[model samples]
Target: MSNQLFIPPNYKPVLNTTRTEKAIKLTKDLFENQLSAELRLRRVTAPLFVLKGTGINDDLNGTERPVSFPIKCMQETRAEIVHSLAKWKRWNLKKLQITEGFGLYTDMNAIRPDEDLDNIHSLYVDQWDWERVITPEERNLKFLKRVVRKIYSVMKRTEYLLYEEYPELVPQLPDNITFIQAQDLQDQYPGLNSKEKEDRAAKEFGAIFVIGIGGALANGEKHDGRAPDYDDWTTPSEGNYKGLNGDIVVWNNVLQRSFELSSMGIRVDAPALLKQLAIANSEDRAKLMWHQMLLNGELPQTIGGGIGQSRLCMFFLRKAHIGEVQSSIWPESVIEVCEKNNIPLF
Candidate 1:
């Protein structure tokens, strides 16, 4: 999410320009180490493009189109660049039959045509996506909290390692994460919209999870929009983390503010998927052929999510510009800012 932070003007790089390359490589390695150790995730190859109507698309907030084109090799197949591997991971888990506790992580690359490019967001999206099979017992609030704690633990561990390896990489992550139910947050500050509450809370308490998502608020408003498939909207808060400012969460939960680093939950079983589809008024999708497999329990029951690699790097590096580390084109305003601040863009 966009958060305002103090930037030092004319602050030239102390380290050589080569650090960007080294930084990205180290970031991948460090993140991989934590993910593999914590989630038992094994690296795998993922699709740059999946067949159209395959239900392999990431419907971020139920909007945004996939970058797609017709493939001649498969004449009938219209392949689209994956928005994220949220659905693909679940399918792979069953296709691969990955056992419980064993999971797969892929370096997912995507083009999000609708993404409003910000300091942290790029048209060229890249991140780590992982999914692991879970037993039926691991689907309650307690189980979810336990998994959240484990994920945070890995992040803490990774932060420590990064600090040690690159002393210049100064990141101050709070040891204790603040977990708040989406409804509780609304209840605490009903007067304020979602972003206001998130900013108020996370600013005071470091990392926070704003639960109670997918549906409308008490006033019949969505805490935030989320797609109906893949995730059981009834069970967990599909809207996850929203980081704090000093952080740019300027406006409330309007189109102005978005803070969901991960959209993970226990994947819906066949029963749950059908129910959610009906609720979302998307039952028609059930007949989409690709969804037929999922409806028949042909997919694995697992938990999966995507993590923003650039955001983590930017936060840790204390660099105001994400372009400093990631090799992506910058908007003119951002580019001007980079040049003005003498912060070299990679």
Candidate 2:
């Protein structure tokens, strides 16, 4: 949450403003098409907000407050701008009768008013939210790893495409992504904090998926917080592990830090939902319509996640600040730092 801006010494943008704008468009288009094809996902329309009290909106980390306002159309009922469409995508799968192995992806734009804006974090969020129906038996670590590899492949391919378009932007991603459990990472770097551990892992592997997020580790601390209802973070995975969810992190040579591009996992089933809800002291959510449908077997079993669009562009294009790729408000302090550092804000 530190607002301190870190600009690498002698940093220079690879593309000018006009070309950066064009590259952003190309990156989004190229990645989206390739991702959809690789995952068998059909692009679908998504909503910016959902009715309050429906348990449909993502309770990211179960802490950050969502931006909500009264809607005059429905007797002024409150509506909350979605943090992410984690649950809604699963609901959509059932509504559309999307068969197994097939899924949907949407351009999800959101406002995270509580986000601590930094070189990477932004108040405005844009990502590719995707979900696919899965069979009951396919909810294991092996299956989750398979999906992660597919997404990583799409990312690598997109990097190559960008290289082809802009020769100055050379591809740096490794051929394959390394996977490690969060507990193992914690054990490896017991003295380091969570972020430090991720930094070490990413730097060492270039790219890695830190599994078992949200759930408590051996030390009774979570690697990071995840909303209980969306990702299955309490299931017993491999030896001593407890979740099927994780994050895709890579070493950002531009920032000299670990950069997270996505968070995804298998959607919680009825048992995992109830267990995680209780663990989170949020069993009351079971009464909401979305929860009711899930508990009653009305929703489909699925795996889904969100890949940050702006983050991808920033990383691939070697920008120092996220503002270089997407337009968003920034505090005067951040603006001053970037201005002094020659890191233009769009």
Best by lDDT: 2
Q: Tens digits of per-residue lDDT for model 2 on 1-346?
A: 3257888898888999999999999999999999999999999999999999999999998888999999888899999999999999999999999999999999999999989778899999999999999999999999999999999999999999999999999999999999999999989999888999999999999999999999999999989999999999999989878899999999999999999999999989999999999999999999999999999999999999999999999999999999999999988887888888879999
lDDT per residue for candidate 1 within 286-319, as digits (tens), equals 8876579887767766777777777666655555
Candidate 2 is scored at a TM of 0.99
Off by over 4 Å in 2: 1-3
Per-model TM-score on C-alpha atoms: 0.86, 0.99
